[model samples]
Structures are given as C-alpha cells and as structure tokens.
Target: MILTSVLPELILLSADFGLIGSPRWRPLAYQYGAFWAGLLHGWQPNFAVQPVTMFLTHAFLHTGPMHLIGNMLALGVLGQMILERHNTGQFILIYIAAALGGGTTYGLLSHSAVPMVGASGAIFGLAGAQLVWRWQDQPKGDLSHLRRLAELCGGMLGLVVINLLMWWLQDGQLAWQTHLGGTLMGVAAAGLLPAQRPILLKIRS
Candidate 1:
C-alpha cells in the first residue's frame, strides 16, 4: 500500500524531469492538485473540485525528486510501524485525517500564493503517531522508564530543530504549518484509535 501511494508521485516526477510523458503534465498536476491558500479566499480555478480535493491530492504531489524521496522513505518506515499495531483501515484513516489536518492548517496560517505540494505533512503525522505508540509501550509505574520518555521528548525537540534548519535553508518556504497540524492530528488519532493485541503462538511438546 505504501508503494501504491508512491506511484503517482513517481510518475509525476518522471513527467516533470522529461523522462517520459509531456513536461506539461507536471504543471497541470500542480495546477489542479496542489493546495492553494487563495482558494480559501474564493479564488476559484477552472476546476471546481480542486478546492476540496487538494486537501488530499496535494499530498501526492511533490516539488522535486528529493522531496518525493524523503517523504516516501518516511511513509514506508513510519507507516509500517503504524500498520504493525493497527489494521489497514486504521492506518488509512489516520493518514487521511493527517492530510486534511495539514491542509486545513496550511489554509489558515500560510499567506503564500504559491501552491503547496508534498507528503511531508502526512509523513510528519505518521511520525507523531509513532511517538505516541512509543510512549504508550513504555513500562508503567517504573521510575527507570523515565529515561525512555525523556528520549521521546528529545526526539520531538530534534524534529523542531530540523524543521527550523530546513525553514532557514529554504528561506521560510517550508509548509511548517502543515507539519504542525498533521503531527497534532496524528497524535490525536493514535490516542483515539485502538491498538491490536499481540498474537501469541503455542508450541506443541
């Protein structure tokens, strides 16, 4: 399923790089698929559905090859982690929720007229859910386990540092608001979703 989610982006990248298909495909995809803050302000494009569909569609688009690769890697790793503890439906639900959350956040906070595209928001959501699972899996009522919680805090701080560095490097072009919203939704979803029970096997003697 993770691979399935990556196919559209790969195809789009190919078109954008002129490897196959018309180069125009990339621009068209962005025109219809990328989220535009202006849309929220009643700036309608030719496509009527774009205003609503862009919430999820923009996640499948990428600004460049590196952007796609990074998000896909995170999706594969963190997504698998999520799938291990929940059913496919739950995974999909969390992903969709995160994407919508990210889009909503971007719509509200960002003033850029440029279309936003990327799966980083959804990927960050998976990371957030993974963090919650780690916290839940820790041994309870044990003072020694405090170190694990601290490590989780450190990990979150590290994410903040990385976001800051990327924002600085990109000249504040990063959609950090989307990342923030997605992560919060992911954490909320993980808390609300049920975890699967561990399967046990019996050995015959």
Candidate 2:
C-alpha cells in the first residue's frame, strides 16, 4: 500500500522510505496499551495543523480484518477487469490516480470532524473504467447486463444508506463521504478511458 505512495517520490526525489507510515488498529492493543499508546497518538491527530498529512495517509489505514476483507473483496472484483486489459504501467497510474481521486474527493466533501480512509474509491475507479470500456466496445448482446449494472448501483446506494444509518448510530466516526466521492468518480471515469478494440470482442455477437 505504501509502495504506491513512495514510488513517485522514490523515482523523483530519491527520498528514503522510512518516515511514511500507516496507522491501523491491531488485536493486541488493549492487551498492551503501553506499547500501542504511541500508535494512537499517530493515528488520530489535529487536522487543522496537519491537513496535508492526513489527506493522503488516512487511505492506507483500515479498522481490522473485517474492514480490510470487505474492502479487498470490492477491489479484487473490480480491479481484476482493469488489470487484465491494461499493462503494469497503466495499472499503476490508474490505481494511484483513482486512489487520490477518491480520497481527495471524500476529503473535500466531508462535513465531519473525523478523518477519512480506505481504498473503495480507487476500486470504484476501476469499475468506472470497466463500465466505460464495455459501453464503447460492445454495442449489443446484453441489455440485461446494463440493467443489472444499474441495479448493482442501486444496491450500492442502499448499502450507502445503511452505512450512513449505522454511522449515525456510531456518532459519525464513519466516512461515507469517501464512498460517495469514489462511486461518482468511478462513474464519471467511464467516459474518460480511451476505447480499445480487442479482436475477439470485436467479432459479431
């Protein structure tokens, strides 16, 4: 995860990768508060004093196994399609762009005091690109797929509603704003990815 952030700097600035950090929770924190106290200090900090610091850093952190698993599942399903079509260079560029795109979009829209995190937005970017490519290349054969995709968006909207409701219950520690930003950006990006014609996909359906 940190590798994505550091690659740009490593290539340009020749900077050491030691200082960049991720602040995630662990299973043993309660059992060893003494050791983890410093972690808490780093994880949550004053945004007014460190807006640039958290804007990028926060995306790398996830709550626990459950949170990480849920996010990775979404990323895997969506990211696979993008990866298969694009080369390594294109993948890296698109992924980081989407990461920053989603993260920054969330940060800009947020009304909450707590900071934002996660890579769902980036995954959504891949989704957006896939939807665009499909539209540009495949002119026919599955209007059902289109409707199902629309339903999928609706289902995700429902999930967003649920996320917000639960977030309200938790007194607003959650950041659904990021999810919203990512989803929109993902949709918008569909129009942006250049159309590529593969031989097999071009054949009559």
Candidate 3:
C-alpha cells in the first residue's frame, strides 16, 4: 500500500539532487524525509523555496518497513473508527492536519539534520480520535463492546506514555514531537467529526 502510494513521489524526488528523501538514491533517501526532498540541497527556513509542496508529500514518504507497518496498522484501526462516526471529508481534513502538525513539529525540532519521513503523524492522529471517544464516555454498550473499547484505549494510552518515558530516559531518535502533535490533532479531530451514540441498554451493573 505504501509503495503504491509513495513510490511515484519517491521517484520524482529521487531525481532532484537536492531532494532529501530521494528514492532514486536509496542509501541517501534513508536519511532524509519526503519533506526534505525539495530541501535536499537548498537552504531552509525559507518557506518561499518549497514548503507548500512538501506539506502534502511529506506524509507519504516513510523511513523503513517498521515505520510503515506501525503507521499503517494504527491508521487502519483508527480510520475505521473515525469513519463510523464521521464523513470522508472530515477524515481527510483530520489526516491533513495531522500530517502538517507532524511535519511542522519535526522541521522545527530536529537538530540532527536528518530528513523525516512516514505517514506516522497522520496515523497517530487517528489513534488520538479513538482516544477522545473513549474518554468522553466510559463503558456503555454491551459489556463486551465496552470492554474491548476500554482495552484498546488503555493499550494505546500505555504505549504513548511508555514511549514518551523511554524517549525522556534515553533521549533517543524517536519522533517524540511528531507523535505528540499527531495524537493531539487526532484527538481534537474526534470533536470535529460528527457523532452518534451507540444504543446501549443496561443489561447489568
């Protein structure tokens, strides 16, 4: 899925000597982000240079297989949940917002000069949207429904907290800022999306 979605840009960006995530130049591409493709050889902090185009393309490029797998999994799960509660337009908007937020955060914070990549930021946003729904209401439907929702929420929350803590402890290369931005945007998107309370009959305490 990622190869089909991102391969085209990867090819185009590869030719441009300056593009950071140059798929044409596999070894080098590993280091830079799709956003950096335009900035590969150019001076940055200059929005006029090519920030707008990067805004859309950055989210498609990913760093590695692991990155793609994690992001795709989260996106698939939360995207379905969001779809259940909202329309396609809203989902698109949320995704865009997440991509932008993640990209901007990475651009502003990274000091290593490494180019960022992946749709992770957007996927994180979808996860956040699911969290928002859970927070708004506790177990309400079938005990099983409520239990699964609770389990999902708890697991996600735990993952985020643990990942953040690990980052703090090791000051590792993980995209902490990007994750935070995407997740927060995703949670906020839940509110923007339309909602319909699932029918719940109290069967037990």
Candidate 4:
C-alpha cells in the first residue's frame, strides 16, 4: 500500500525530468508533473473542476527531490505503523481525508498564487491519527497512559515550535496552514473509527 501511494509521484517525476522524452519542461512539465498536478489535470483552484479533486491529485505531486524524499520518508515510517494497527482501507481513508482537508484549507486561506504541493499534510495527518489511537486505547487511570500522553503532547509542541521557526526563517514559504488542517482532519477521522485494543493494552492486561 505504501508503494501504491508512492507510485504516482514517481511516474509524474519521470515526466518532469523529461525522462519520458516529452517536450514538457520547466513550468509546464513541472506544473503538470509536480507540486500542482491539478493545473495539468484541468482543475484550477477556484475556477474549474470541483476543488475537492485537487485534494487527492495534489498529494500525488511533489516539488523537487528534497520534497519528494522528505514526504516519502514520513509516509514510509509513520504509514507503516498505522497500517500495521489498522486495516489498509482505514489507513487510506486517513490519508485521503487529510489530503483533502489540507488542500481545502490551503485553497481557501492562502493568498499566494504559487501552487501548493507536497505530502506533508498527509504525513501530519498520519501523526494525528497515531496520537488519537494512542490516546483512545490508553488505560483508564493508568499512570503509564498519562505519561505517554504527556510525552506525545510534548512531541507535538516541539513540532509546532519547529514549524513556526521554519515559517519565520523562510519568510512564510512553509505551508503550515495545510499541516494544521491535515492534523485536525486526521484526529477527527481517527475519532470516528471504532476503538480497538492496542497491543500494549493486551500486554498490560
């Protein structure tokens, strides 16, 4: 499933580098193959096909090597854990919901004309889902559970601080907005799922 999620990005990237021998290059090929596939797919923000489609399409696109590698790394690591605990379908659901939520938030809120792209939103969504899952299965009145939640909260806070610092240092190029939206959507989506006994819970019991 992780491979499935990554295949589109790889195919589009092949097109971007002119590896496919097509004339499309730079902005044309880049716009079509990377970051904002929505433009090439005939779905311009605020003008063409339903914006919702962009949510899914944009996620499959990426800006550059660093962008692609960073996102894929997160997807590989976090996605694997989530998929192990939940079914593939549920993992996919969280991903889709997070992408849509991130894109929606960016489309509605960002003032920049530069096309938004990347899997950070969905990756953050995975993190959000993991947090929720941990919290949900935490034992009642267990000090260990409380400690775990606290640690999780601390990690989240650290991430937020890092994002804020990056946003400032980079002169607001970072899409913290999408990250925020994706996280919220992930948590909400995970909350809707029926609770399951985590492996840790089993061991403790």
Best candidate, lDDT: 1
> Candidate 1 on 1-205: residue-level lDDT in tens?
4564578777877787889998898889889989999998979675868789999988878887777777888788987788778888988888988998999999999878999998888888888888878777765544356676786787788778888998999898899999988988888998898767433323233
Candidate 2 off by > 4 Å: 1-50, 140-174, 197-205
Segments in model 1 whose C-alpha atoms lie over 4 Å from true places: 17-20, 144-152, 197-205
> Candidate order by lDDT, highest to lowest?
1, 4, 3, 2
Q: Give the TM-score of candidate 2.
A: 0.57
lDDT per residue for candidate 4 within 123-152, as digits (tens), equals 888888888786666665665766877966
The better candidate by TM-score, 3 or 4, is 4
Per-residue lDDT of 36 in model 4: 46
lDDT of 4: 0.71
Give the TM-scores of the predictions, in the order they appear.
0.86, 0.57, 0.65, 0.78
Q: What is the lDDT of candidate 3?
A: 0.65
Query: lDDT per model, in order?
Result: 0.82, 0.52, 0.65, 0.71
Model 1 lDDT, residue 30, Cα: 89
- TM-score, cand. 4: 0.78
Between candidates 2 and 3, name the one with more favorable lDDT: 3
Off by over 4 Å in 4: 23-26, 29-47, 144-152, 165-171, 201-205
